[model samples]
Target chain A: MNERVGTTVLSLTGISKVYGEGPTRVDALRPTAFEARAGEVVAIVGPSGSGKSTLLTIIGLINPPTAGSLLINGEPVITDGVAVANLTTMRRRELGYVFQRSNLIPFLNAEENVRLALEIDGVPAHQSRTRARELLESLGLGKRLAALPGKLSGGEQQRVAIARAMIHQPSVVLADEPTAALDSGRGRQVMELFRDSAHAHGAAVLVVTHDHRTLDLVDRVLEMEDGVLSEKQPA
Target chain B: MMDLAVRDIRNDLSRFLLTAAGLGMLMSVVLAMTGIYNGMVVDATVLPDTYGGDLWVVQKGTQGPFAESSRVPALLADRIRAVPGVERTRSYMTLNVQHELGDGETLRFMLAGLSWPDDLGNSLPLAQGRALRQPHYELVADRALGLPVGTSLRLGRDDYTIVGITSGMVSSSGDPLVFASVSDALRIQNDLASEALRLERESRVSRVRRSEYGRDPANLARAGSAAPLPVTSPPPVTAILVDVAAGGDVEAVKASLLGWPDISVYTIDEQRELLVRGVIDRARRQIGLFRALLVLISAIVMGLIVYTMTLDKMLSLSLLKLLGAKQRVILRLILEESLLLGISAYLVALLIGELAFDLFPRRVLVQDLDRLALLGVILGLSVAAGMVGLRKALAANPNEVLAS
Candidate 1:
């Protein structure tokens, strides 16, 4: 499957992050190299304070790497230590994010929450609404389209968040503990959704998680320890 | 942006409306203050408007007839009318008096005396019945006092019939106007009290004369017949009103009147300035201060409310930023909500203002132009208020989403 898909959706070389300088200086992430090809779902498992979040944020273009180069869809977004253009626009065009909590806008209903991303991208309102409804229904949230975030249960909220993340079909999707609040069964279901998202939409999915039970759903598994990353071996 | 704002307000419609209504009530008070000032101006000019006089001739060195007391001869109207370029002349007198209804309801009224002949330019415009036609015992009262035609009331030992009724007739101080013949007003205001005093003095003198010569009736009759008591006449009028001939130079007429050392003349413009700047100066300042205070309170209240709403949505806004929303998107959203709040409050304020105007004891005049101008000001101020919330929203950090 990796041989069939030759394009790299996200790639990073010598990526490093430093908090401050001198005595207060803290290296959140050491210089590292990473890549994710099209049609692959990669999982990063680590203990707390392992810099998994910092690495994900740098890859997602939320925080610029202190020393590195980043490429999305084979296009250079960051060279050396500076961004080429507007990072916000770049993030909106190429990246999708799902946080640990559902983080849905409480005022908006499920469909509206999904449509907001497209609306931010300057999509026409009518088209955005229709696409949001279709995506939510595809995720088995058809009846919950008009329900506000507070009205939905834990699993439903996570599913709505998933729909929002995948609404724009970006080149890469970065999710941090996407199902930390759900039970084991629901967590596995969400991980399977990520796998399907990568294969069906050809998106490169990167998820940071502690749930080892859903490791079988990803094409490759990596481990982070004190800001360092290495591929995991088969059990 | 509008759609998003509309939905957000609809989601919490009760909270949004309550905030808007509170703001609207404050704005209504602002409107009421403005209306009160307008009403004061109207009241200040109502008497002059009713008289329609081009110039006023009063005692020298006086601002009469509203701002100061002036006494001139009643016969001056004839001389003033004879001056070149003088179209017409009418001697007028105004006495501020309290009419005791005998029920603890003492109503302040302006008793105005106008020239006779029952013609235009001298009589008040009646809303019902006829103008004052009788010389000594007729009155035309303002309808605001609820005085009906044919109602008779005693004024200074004389029963005067209400022969006419006029609307919108008020004094410079907002007292209702009551018009009567010049002689009737003069006698009622000046002669009646002096006449009573004179009779009492004569009676006392007669008694003293009888006491001194009680033993001799013939001597007493001779003394009473030999020395007659003196009579007191009514005091002169307050001012005389003059009209300029068609297309006449009012300055020429005024200059001619200045030659008379005992009297002064004023054009319409001069009287208006005296009334607004001099007469009502203190009240205007008070009203202006109240308006400024209300506006300041409105801005603070509006800004605080929007800032609080922004605080409430801070978390959600941070999540949006994390999800890749641009700063403009978030800023637009907050601004749209602020605009909606402002417009809604203005609408509620207009309704409340109309209701309050009808119930206020004094006149509250709300003009259409005034309302529109107020609305524009409120909307603009509301937008200014949005900046407070916009700043809060902009200061939201997207990294908070990860921290949570």
Candidate 2:
């Protein structure tokens, strides 16, 4: 699996996540197998508490599965049994996260929020600012760069979050309900941004959203139930 | 790498400012206490240093002129001058009394007796005009009292004229020193009233006897009526100021005065030390208490701030952790916030200390080094406080968020 310009960008085989111990243990995500390749938007759909987030978390490398292989870009990072610690540095440099609520830091302006990942990546100030400006402009947030999180509308905040996630040009972008806070029109715009960004960047974009109306933007739709995921839209 | 403390402070300016203000007030209080003590010590030794004496002889077992009552016989200077290595000795009658001015203002003045014309013994090195030259009439007063030259007032019984004023001649404990001739001061000290006025205040029977009897009543006759009234000699002179002879062995001379019954001897340096320590003791203790309390308050406030901040950011911290933010990154953020709070409060404290010192009644006398020292102290305290917050932040479990 090569997350960047590869056939399989992400692979999860025999992945399981359990909570608690002994009698109280819950297998949130049962042993599962899935793959998302380059230039694809994998929509992971499920009812609340139906293990959708668990599977997404496992795939996103935010939560490691109890038993499985999590291969990224053809390399086995989490193989058969255990997660390697050095994956954190890799994830930060190569992966981006977007939450449902836009979870933007309140103090920073939209541009600074977008530039944060670059700064964390040790990019020089002038170059990071230039890239941040360019990215925000491309995302139609040029005028809103200096506006704080509170000043922006819900749709704009999500757009800023999207920009922040994609600004680092990560090979994999994981958005959990990225359009949940916006109206239908704004939701449609957000879905379009992800689709366009994924197509242009040639990176695998995985989004777990309940809004089926904008499912057209995704290249693949996966429905999850009781830790099991099935392809709703065939390849 | 990101200057987390500054960035966080910038994010919530109002919170930072409010914390700074609170710490500033505490710093001001600490500064005020320090100033009061410094002023007191300065006031206590001003007289001893300005008087510039090599030796002081006062009554024995007394802390000397300032701490307790001290006296020597008025004529004791004659004997003291005869002692080997005695340079020059001056006798003075000093008594603490309040003077009521014509303007209804009362001031505590030390009646300093002197013999003038020669201006040998009782003289203030004139900072402004000449010393008091007239023996019986003119007076010299401390310049700290704000009295102009030639200002005169009636003290006790005599109507004295102020001919000159001197600077830096005030006595220990802030009493204005009044320079008058020895004869005049003795009159006020020993012989102000006539025989008639003395009898007038006695018992009616005792008061009438001197008038009924012969004008010069015999001692036996006087003693018969008054139960052998022990002659209470003039309240012995306050203290005798002594100057060592040119190339005088001051140590040897001081050793001789120790044998004199009911008298203590002190060099100028020793007197100044006693005076300074005496005046500053109480103020020192009070200031020390204030310093301790301010430090405790600073520590507590910083700790509370760190704790509160950690609690507020717990969810975000957990989210970051879940996103594979290493514990070191989390640790850095927690440490940064803690330090940010401490440094902000320290700056606030410094400003407050400056303002408080400026407005306080006494001279605060804060130097640059004190500021630097205080800054160091604040930094140490801040880091200590932040540790409390950092501990809790470190303990926060990313697994907690997933539970619910």
- Which candidate tops DockQ? 1
What would the per-residue lDDT of candidate 1 be over residues A1-235, giving only the tens digit for each residue?
3332547988889899999999999998998899998778899999999999999888877788899899988888988868986788777778888878888888899999999888888898899989999888888999999999999998899889888888888788888998788899999999888877676667788999998988998888989998889899868
lDDT of each: 0.84, 0.73
Q: How close is candidate 1 to the true structure, as a TM-score?
A: 0.92
lDDT of candidate 1?
A: 0.84
Q: TM-scores for all candidates?
A: 0.92, 0.83
Q: After superposition, how far is residue A185 of candidate 1 from its true place, in Å?
A: 1.9
Winning candidate number (TM-score): 1
Please list the residue runs of candidate 1 whose C-alpha ends up more than 4 Å from where it truly belongs after superposition: A1-6, B118-125, B191-196, B199-234
Reference contacts recovered by each candidate, as fractions? 0.53, 0.19
The segments of candidate 2 whose C-alpha lies over 4 angstroms from its true place after superposition are: A1-3, A60-64, A79-81, B82-86, B90-95, B102-104, B109-150, B160-197, B200-235, B245-249, B259-262, B276-279, B309-363, B367-369, B395-404
- Winner by lDDT: 1
Candidate 2 displacement at residue B246 in angstroms? 6.2
Q: Clashing residue pairs, candidate 2?
A: A1-A73, A1-A74, A2-A73, B60-B262, B60-B263, B87-B245, B114-B182
Q: Model 1, B1-404: lDDT tens per residue?
A: 22667777888999999999999999899889888888888888887777767899988999877688789988888888899999888878888878887667876788888777633223567788887656778888888777799988789888999888888787767788888887888878864576677676678557757685534777666546636444343468888889999999999899989999999889877887888888888898998899889888889999999999999888888877877788888887889999999999999989998776878867888899879988887888788889999999998887777777
